[model samples]
Target chain A: MSTLIGVDWGTSSLRAARLDAAGEVLEERSLPRGILTVPAGGFPAVFDEACGDWMREPGALALLCGMAGSRQGWVEAPYAGCPAGFADVAAQLTWIEPGRIALVPGLTCHEHGVPDVMRGEETQVFGALELLGLQSALLVLPGTHSKWVRVIDGGIDRFATFMTGECYGLLRQHSILARMMPAGDGELDAAAFVQGVHHARRSGTLLHAAFSARTLALFERLAPAAVPSYLSGLVIGEELRVQDLRGTLSVAVIGAQALTCRYELALATLGVTVTRVGSQATWRGLRAIASTLQGTS
Target chain B: MSTLIGVDWGTSSLRAARLDAAGEVLEERSLPRGILTVPAGGFPAVFDEACGDWMREPGALALLCGMAGSRQGWVEAPYAGCPAGFADVAAQLTWIEPGRIALVPGLTCHEHGVPDVMRGEETQVFGALELLGLQSALLVLPGTHSKWVRVIDGGIDRFATFMTGECYGLLRQHSILARMMPAGDGELDAAAFVQGVHHARRSGTLLHAAFSARTLALFERLAPAAVPSYLSGLVIGEELRVQDLRGTLSVAVIGAQALTCRYELALATLGVTVTRVGSQATWRGLRAIASTLQGTS
Candidate 1:
């Protein structure tokens, strides 16, 4: 029988994991029922459609994370302030249903003058800390909005969000640069990407460096197929350059293989070590959150 | 009677000025017949519709500049190589109809590793120099693609193009940042904009700095209406930061008053002097080009 279910609900998609008393995944399912696609007051039904089949027994505690907790989400789960540990975050959990469905609160960093916020990445960040067993370290979670987190003594001290992936997406798909490239996604062109990184290392600004992706094509230095990868490298490299990476020996990259590898390549070029954490990190964190709820109940 | 017509036909709009034998504008007209909006093979008709009235007399020479001469434009006018002065550039003019209609060639920076092209700004740069009577100085034309032009000994020696304005438009209209701001073009908030420029002076990358526009809004430190101006500052600031501005006594900003003023504010903040040139720069450049053609013929 399923003792718990963990949900990672984001803007574009929803994923679920069914777990036993030990918090190991017994079965899993995913659907494209992201909050953006769901109509008003339709999330409960949509959630059931995505995971109803996996719920064999009656009362499996459901722990939800990500945008499902935002104001525009199903029910506003509110945000937990930063410098919070797993327990501090877990305690502030608000539920969609009084007992059946619990939504994990997102976090906000008040350390900086302007506060930065994240939804799903906080779980992955906490999980990364637990798996790596590090007291103070830098972590990077790359996506539409890439996050750079600082962890100290089992709590998230502070973090900054870089719209690297999102900016790259918008530029490639919508900007004038899109016209220069061929349709569909491109494979990683490591050399072209590294060339982009080298260009970013120069004193030129990003607004100026960004045009190099197109100029490189015009000059025949980079091919059309490699333009996306090169552009990706350009943005990612610039993102890394501005960070005070000095004295930071290594960075923990928590994300999938394809995306993280790009960051790994960029970091490697900068002479920093990297540790890759797979998507399972999110699930592991969810399972741990579920376990805590189980203990209290 | 009209002795000449200078047309600035770009991707989104077409503008023409009828000039007398003395290089004075006798009449002017503009239409939304930019190359991108016109149907394929419909340019001749569209051109006629825009300024056919000015072409009443058959001998009224038409000198077309900008995208109307691109490969996708009316006819492909190949680029003039850099270090090219008036004589070198004017020699490469390819005509639609000899002695009646001519398209000025654009410029390519073959000196730089990555070649950059500008279809319409060349005339503006030349005009700024002609109007100001400068033999050598730095020029910046802010637009979709902001160009930093260097004039030496009365010729465009070399220059760079930054996608500062275009990137800002794309991000504000199509990216996630759009959701954070109010609808329609926003009024400038000088304080918010200066705040963005100040952030650019920091070590954080543009990718990270860009998010501050949203974060500052989230924390209620900035008004939603001011976010656009703030973002504009962030981009223009980053664009200025990368360029080596030390010992450059003054920068000639050639564009509309509103746009040039923002650049002026940014440059002034960086402690550089700015010289503002108006829209007549393009028209003036076109007139000079006509005068040169008249002398040669």
Candidate 2:
């Protein structure tokens, strides 16, 4: 029985998991070494440092996902076009050490002549599906770039990326709205956040809605501490506002607890139920892909 | 026949015009000394430096507009509630040297319990109306914060502020999309820009439409030099999208030529006509208010 060392290496951080043959995680480790921080040609060294011991084990197969497979990573794994299933993705893995180490080719889909690509979230989507036991579902992986994905018949149908998280960070830190917010992170003011969500619907566009963060504070209506929460709600709410959530019963929220919680609240406000999934989806997803590749080999 | 020193002082730069009794420009001067750059109690010095010679003249009353009236500027100029015209704005002016130096009280309007205020744009809105000699029209002042104003019966009825410019600067300079764009300002790619404008409508929200700027580049569909123009179109297009341009035949675009030209192209794409107005609207606006104040005195 071969052990699988699955890694979810994104732009800012890396997480690795060692799973047994049954796809159960036996141990896991997280590091600050996201692809961006890794020095040029240092990916192999960082990978070794992350799970060198696990790699030393005979019959150990490794699967890496996320920005690690991007153009800037160790090796560029070309994106697999959408409507891709576990088998489809497994077949497209770019091998680093043939028959031992491989990288997952992220998924891309086109709409109206524009291409939308996801490096790591595709793996998590499949994992979320398997964990939730759903053949088709709408999954939202909210992060720096929030992905609204659709799964049908155990494959990623199509997805859209909203720069919600990144925009929020820019507005909170670099934009004029930052001047109205407190110096550091503040407690999420639930009421203010809800107000922002609702305001987004009324404000009509994020470009206009974002300014409310400043005006609300300027008028003494929203406290400076609550500005961050309000701004978060505005961006999140804008992200949700564009999607046609009508008749959709529930959405699977994937990411860390803090981020997922915010999405959950925002979704709940719009009368949509949410199923929470942890980062374990990444490991589970890589495990599924590895298992499929193993069977094919 | 008294002369008026009309100042358009904003966050980044200050422009002052010494106008004769006929409102014709006698002398014009612009400095890097904006409200933000003016040190504590230094506005007077900077103001003097900008137009001290003009201010030294007997009966040279001064009318200042823009951020100079904000809480952070020379003195906090409380916003005058809207439906403000030349007379209304003149009445609310905060006097610095009683009847000699006054700051134009910018306009504020409320909708759905949210307040939208403009410090500098209100002046431009009035000036745009006066410049075009129209009692009622839809005017757009595009800049760091774009304003869509509806003029009715020669008064500033109500307006909405879109943080389009500021958001564009933040995204172009700080966001991930910046990585794909060339380091310096790129020439406007007319075709790519038009595509971006049209894409904004299809993408449904700026949050989503912005990601296309990256994906299009990643796929090599959009040139690196064209990214900035495309982004400019996306934000400007989104600003135009939310407005009910149904019956608006023509929109008076008041701003710098570079910005107004972009707005003109975008508005033209949407089947609306645009009349370009210059920054002179600020001076004209203040002159009108000063003239109104002089008549009353």
Candidate 3:
């Protein structure tokens, strides 16, 4: 049995975890050195600084995911089309150091002639599946860009991406709606948020629904403090509104607590059960793929 | 008959018209002096700079609309509730001067307890009515905040606002989708724009539809020059998707050419007749309101 170094490198940050052959966490590190900050021809140095020691160990393999596989990252790893499984992803790795370090390819799924792509998230999806011990599940990973995924027979069948969080930040900070909101962040107001979620149901579309944040403030019906919560509810609710959650017994939500919690509440309101998976899914996902590469490496 | 000065002062720009008793445009001036750019206690001075000479004439009445009546503008004119007519708006005018000058009040409509407010658009709706000579009509004013107005019996019955333009700008310039797009403005690609509108119909929601801008570009299905047009189509299509345009015979689109032309195309694609009214509607609407103030002033 050999060690594995798992790297989840995204647009904004880089994270790494070292796992023993048993897939137990041994050591971990996180840094703001995301792929975007790395200058051209500098990913090798950054990679060395992050986990050169771990890679020096005999027969220790490294698997990198997320934007690190993007065209602008260390090396461009072509996307694996869905329905892809662990073996499918493992077989497509772009080896940085032959048989040692490789970039895990992202996933691309086509819908209505348009291509939807995901980098590190595909790994998180696989990790959630591994942790929850489910060969098939419905999953929603909410973030700057939220992905609603479908897993069938132990592989990713198809998925959709929604710019819910990015839209929220843009409206909350840059749009006219921001004028009525307070400068800094506010705690999530449950009641206001629920009201927002309900409003989204009746408001027809987000383009129209988002305007309520302003009117709600102007009429003194929503406090300055609760505007953010309400806005969050609108976007999150809209995200859920477009999803065909019927017959969806339970959805595995993989993301940070703050975001998944909002999805949990919205889904619960719609009578859908939710299971949460955290950042660990990224490691477990990388390890799962790395495990498949065992002996072959 | 008394002379009339019609001023449309909004957040980003100011325009004024000196009209004869017959509602003919005698003189006109446009400046970059929007309410947002005006210094504190500077509305009166800026107003003077734009149309002071026109106002100095004996018995010349001024009716200013748009953000000039907003809380942060010249004077905080209370919004007139729908179903409000010309008379209702005229009655609520915030008098900057007893009889010589006044700020036209905006209109507010309620839907399921949430409020939708509009300032300058109200004037444009009335002006569109005057130009089209229709006592009842459905009009859409496309801008930063697009308004879908319903006028019945020569009054604003009810309206809804969609953040279509603002959302398009935010996504095209600030979001991840921007990364795939070219810098600066691009010419409207009719084919790409139409494809986007059709795609929006199938995408279900703008949140999901917008991602296609990137995906379409990534797959090389959409060119960089056409990304903006595609995005614009997505938002505008979404805006129209939520509206109950079933019973409408024709929509009066009042806006600048670049915007109204797009709306014209989208609405036309939906098999709805579109009647475009230019910015002159503001002056015509104000003149119509001033005609009623003739003897009283």
Candidate 4:
């Protein structure tokens, strides 16, 4: 049986999967070392330590995605523009070691006269399309930099990135918003989340709305426990409102359950149907890219 | 010289000025140490280090405002509710030393179903009203947490705090928006700033509008030097938008020139007349509070 290595190398961690020719996961491993961890000329060494054992068999191809293909990444695959699909990405693959290992390029677009870019979400987006046979839809990949992608006719048309998760992290941990919130994990408050979503949808700029998180606590209107969840909804809601997805019939929210669920709740409040999908899109996407490269070879 | 100390003690720094009965500045002093530097029972020592030299006189009385009176400040001066004036705040001063050292109280308002509080801005707002001798005016005090106050007759009606400056600081320093911008203080690009204000006024949520700061750079529509100014305009614009200040005839923008000009430009874009007032509002406000206390004594 033919086997392949599918690796998702990001800013903070490395996640790798060993998949068969049929794209079935045989084994999976994760390491803390991402491209950022690599010192001077340390890519091969880090890759070996993380996934070289799985790559012991020659002819077994490896396909990588994420920041690994960024400018500061292992090898710059550049970026394929919007309306790009698997073939477009695979065509631009930078071969660290041809056939043995290749990295997929990300997607870039000038939407609304603004240059927007996404690295790994392109892979997951294409993956979601192939897995669900989606002809056209809006896909949201929630993360540190959450992306709202537009896919049409089996290709990415354009996408916008909202620094929702990253902003949330900074607000909850570093900004004045942190003053009212309790430390560590807490239960999700759906009511507060919904309220936050409603606030985002209804009126005012995020500049003023953000203060509600703190004021709500000061007034004893919102408990400290719910501040984080409220903030999550506040930011996520702002993202959803800004995307103005009210007209979009459906949106595919693909990511970890925790993050996607927040998007799902916020989107649902906007009257748009939401389809929750797991991180499988990454694997499916990497596999598709790898297969296309092999076919051309 | 009948001298008195007017202190604006905040979270990070202590600013003090000795004013005679005429409310004219005699001697001014500023120290890096604020409420944050005060250790357990160390307020007196820190106070001495900062302004104790002037306080050695027998008849010298100190009127302090700002974070020094917060729950975490020098002394907990309970907040006076809205429609609060000099009497309302001065009544709540938690005197460290009777008639000698008095800290002014902040103002709290449950305006829009959320609890909001202001410490130093309360003093500044009242000070601005008395200094400008204006009635029924919307007072805008720009700072880390900008306050939009309402003054009627001779009292503070109510106010809303927008974290415009604080939020701007976070986005410029910590968020993904920082990735594209050049480091350190760049000259304010008024043209770029006006563009940002227009964008904020034109469309989408602040969440989406903020991303434009980065995307504008990516498209080469904006240069790196202008990002900070654009960001400043963006948040200030949002603050103006959410304040629903369109109908207000004129706004009293009281703060440092740098922050107030951004607000002035933004408010002017909205067609609302803006009246720029200096940081003298803080000193004037404290002087008013001190005179009231003396009259009561």
Clashing pairs in 2: none
**Considering every candidate listed, which one attains the maximal DockQ?**
2
Candidate 2 residue lDDT tens string, B1-297: 688999989899998998876667888888998888888989888988998888888877988998999888999999999878767887888999987898888889998878999988888877778888999999998888889999899888899999998999999999999898889876788888888889997788998999999988888888899999899889988998899888888999987888888888898887899999887788778777876775554
* Candidate with the larger DockQ of 3 and 4: 3
RMSD of each: 3.1, 1.5, 1.5, 3.4
For model 1, what is the alpha-carbon lDDT of residue B77? 92
Q: Can you give the DockQ of every candidate in the order shown? A: 0.67, 0.91, 0.84, 0.58
TM-score of chain B of each: 0.94, 0.97, 0.97, 0.95
DockQ for model 1 equals 0.67
Q: In model 2, where do residues sit more than 4 Å from their true spots?
A: none
Kindly list the per-residue Cα lDDT of model 4 for residues A176-270, writing each as its tens digit.
87978889748789999988887766545666678888777766788889888888888887887767565787899899898777877777776
DockQ metric, candidate 3: 0.84
Write one digit per residue (lDDT tens) for candidate 1, span A43-144: 989888877766546776788899998777888887788888888887888977766788888988853366789998988887777777787889999988
Docking quality category of candidate 4 according to DockQ thresholds? medium
Supply candidate 2's per-residue lDDT for B67. Answer: 92
